[model samples]
Target: MQLFAYLESFPILHIFELLELTLAIMIKRLLFEEAEITAREFKIVAITGPRQSGKTTLCKHVFKNKHYVSFEDLDILEEADSSPRSFINKYKDGAVFDEIQRVPGLFNYLQTHVDKVGKNNQYVISGSNNFLLQQNISQSLAGRAAYIELLPLSLLELQEHWGNTKNPVFFMMNGFYPSIIAKQSSAERWLPNYLKTYIERDVRMIRNIENLNLFSKFVKLAAARSGQILNVNNLANETGVDNKTISAWISVLESSYIVYRLQPYYNSFNKRVIKSPKLYFYDVGLLCNILGLNSERAIKQSNMYGAIFENLVISEIKKNRFNKSQYGEMYFLRDSTGNEVDLVLEKDGNLIPVEIKSSAKYRSSDLKNLKWFQRLYRIKGGMLINQSTENQELEDGIMNIGWAEVANV
Candidate 1:
């Protein structure tokens, strides 16, 4: 029988199962395309991202025919730890090593193996802790490995896999972790557990913190301050820790991919720009969880609604750029005089200033900062990203893009 006829002949429940399975296989990750291209040019490819950000799934999916081994297996880790050379020899044909940070010594052996073989795409390595993975790469696998960051699912990926919906508010509140979408799990249950696992295990492994409670408090405080300029002194006072300590903790969070700091854009013409970097969480769902926002209604009514919206847009831009194998430098343009542009994307010598808003209505004042930025920089175009559904060209070069259409912009 033909495929459609055969599927139709199955019971209703069975058809649903078949459809789910098909979708599970058909879902293509944005990074997977670039990863495959990188693998062809490098001896080794290292995929690093936050834990549970679909690193394992992306690597496996892209290199489906390759042998796979995970260092997370205690016995395998012990074996690899004891005899790195021997363990590497066993996968001489090439293999995917998941969580290779757990086996740091293996990098030296892999380096030797790749040096002798001199083959492209001979080994695929993945890790959740970028600091450890990057250190190992720099020390042992430099000039041999192609580093690719796989952040959480982008809005484009979500739209491609799951049909686009009108309710972006729901997505912003829930965030875009792959497993949460694949399993249709509740963010309330998943995010808390994710936070606990990351804090109790990953943080401990990365740093030696005496008081978990204090670290947890610091994380929450940082989340509360998301989208605001990072002030180490203020954070130190709020957390009751020294500025140096606060800086160290924030570094740990940044290295672990928990948060990202958007540096301010300063030019000769704009000498008044603030030098401080702005803080934003990599995942808004985790931010919401940290802030104890349990429902969509709460998020909508909260005073931080605009900041959270800005955070989502900025992160999406970052993810989209990374997925395309482009290291687009993103910054916020703000001056001491209080003139600010929410996001400034610098690519190919052109600066694209983006202004973000949570409201559906577009006002002339919304583009005030963008227009000023254009005049100062002598730029022809900019964008105003907001919740409005329609895309409009409000002026000669200023375009008002809706939140859903941000990926395309």
Candidate 2:
């Protein structure tokens, strides 16, 4: 087939080719909320997230009328590197450069160019990995840019796309990747593809690991230990990977927004406290898949039930804090002496302690650690989250609510 004939054969494909950014997603309303914040006063809006999380699509949608280009294309990357000023001149004005970190030096050029040559919304840059992109942009576009992160689509965002559902089981199994939800496919099919592609793309782009097969196994091992107090040495010993490699790989995961670490609260107390951070998979569905739990039935019968509950409670609360106008912080209470609470929430100078139980039957025993935390923090009230019938405030004055209300908790 001739070149023009091949192009003519698929006219529709060329007619409207999307850049695979935010607009290709159904969570536009949620992303719009994020865009509104960035568009406020900052000269540069750098939207960063893991690969395949829709950074490019959203930016194009927001900057549809502006000059749009992607550094993912090698030619443009070379053009920006060889002649940045010419690249700027080429794009008349207000330009959106997708995956701009492909050429870090270009940010230095934009810092001055956007000011002298263009208007408020003149330039937008996107990057997949912050490990390399952070230092580049900081040295160049530090104060001039307004930055926001785009993690895997949130539950509320997914709710906007799929409407509402009563399936906590669905989230635990499928996780909330945008492509998986927007297209609305079965968890069994998409989760495997998601893992294979995500590992192949992100792991190679950020670092040069000699053994990718080992690194892949490491991801699965890390998933099994989600929502637990992580001991780096222990993990390294189990995976047969050195402690340094484990630490570096975990940092890669953080920059990619695949997992998060919550630090323990430190206070002035005689009882020694464990200062180590706890680990959590940002997407519970991905975590479950990594653990090899196939379905809702598998999850319900697993020994990881307590840990899953912990992940649910912590993630839901963290999501709530981020979604609101005010920012709220999450903490866990644990001491060297061995007294611990499953989750701790700190906001507006107050400490709220919560304990999670796997059972539906209620008892004061469930609130033991919360009661202990209350004495130290003067907590407004303690909470015991359980899987049960109704939400109640116990006679001891602690709020005990069913864990099923995690969405509202």
> Cα deviation in Å at residue 290, candidate 1?
0.7
Candidate achieving the largest TM-score: 1
| TM-score against truth, every candidate | 0.93, 0.88
Q: Can you write out model 2's per-residue Cα lDDT over 1-409, one digit (the tens) per residue?
A: 6855755765563423442343364366355566756765677787777766666667767777777788877888898899987887787466777877678777766777777754566677788877667777778877777776666666555555667544566678877666566554577787777778767877787787778789888898898888878899988998898999899999988877778899888877634878889999877877888888878899999999779867866776666555453466788888877789888877677777888887888876787788788777665586788777689888557888876565565
Worst 10 residues of 2 by lDDT: 14-23
lDDT, candidates in the order shown: 0.87, 0.74
**Against the true structure, candidate 2 has what lDDT?**
0.74
| Distance from true location, Cα of 265 in model 2, Å | 0.6
Model 1 Cα displacement at 97 (Å)? 0.6
